[model samples]
Target: MPSTRSQVDTLESGLPYDYTDDEFDPDYRESSEEEEDEVPKTMQRDRAKWIEDNVEDIEFLYRQLMRDGRSMFGDSFLQTGTINTFANFLYRNTTPFSEA
Candidate 1:
């Protein structure tokens, strides 16, 4: 385990401002299991509208960061192609998607 000083120093680096409150809960980091729970009708129905308002700005920042990160390392498309081939190998061996 890391020492407390190292963990506390993480905040001095300036975390991204767009980090969501939803991710704070360990349960909803993301969901892949059956979401049997339904949203109550009383809740605001404009949730999609709210997300639409900001998603583009969020995506723009994400793309900028990715671009800057790539420039810093000077990586090549071959790196992605190699990863895709490896993923295909794993998926083909493990799932019916390969047969289709």
Candidate 2:
């Protein structure tokens, strides 16, 4: 019979994983990896045009009442989803909000 500790280790090892270093990929993370790895060959040719079409950045800030004056950056990147959401917000930002 397997003990709790052994069962936990088995479950943990079977769980799944993905990283830039992974040679083979699981179906779930494969598509995402492709998107991040290749940004369309056409875009790579022209730096300005490429950046204009695909959103990108290094820093961000949220002026919301709760998180007022707060900011985000590459180091603050929690994960792919979080970074994507914040980056999208910054890309579309046109004006700042005030707490007053």
Candidate 3:
């Protein structure tokens, strides 16, 4: 059994005394690479499904904004320059329209 102090040290360090640096190990690297390859396909499919499910709500919000003649951002929301700037900002900063 580990002493209380040793357990505390392990918790503080966020690692066990017997922990090996598997990152540099070839077997570990190969398994991680396989995981990485599988991750993107799953992520993309999930993202697409989320977008599909929410698209109607998104469109409804846009229509409401247009009908009310109110810009959620500000009074200048309808201006082309403001729209361009906002679009550019969103494109640069957001991931897959999530931020907007």
Best by lDDT: 3
Give one digit per residue, the lDDT tens place, for model 1 in 1-33. 866664442355686445576678677656432
Instruction: Note each model's CA RMSD in angstroms.
Output: 17.1, 11.8, 13.0
lDDT of 3 by residue, 27-99 (tens): 7644463342232443556555654665666556555655566555666655543332333333334446332
What lDDT would each prediction earn against the true structure?
A: 0.45, 0.39, 0.48
Using TM-score as the measure, the top candidate is 3
Residues 1-100, model 2: lDDT tens digits: 7666633423456754434446464543545644543433443444334335554332333223114423434333343445444443443342233101
Instruction: Order candidates by TM-score, high to low.
Output: 3, 1, 2
| TM-score, candidate number 1 | 0.26
Sort all candidates by lDDT, best to worst: 3, 1, 2
Residue 14 in candidate 3, Cα distance off native in Å: 38
lDDT of 3 at 70: 55
Reference-based TM-score of each model:
0.26, 0.22, 0.27
Q: Comparing candidate 2 with candidate 3, which one achieves the higher lDDT?
A: 3
Model 2, runs deviating above 4 Å: 1-32, 47-58, 61-100
RMSD of 3: 13.0
Model 2 pairs whose backbones collide: none
Regions more than 4 Å wrong, model 1? 1-48, 76-100
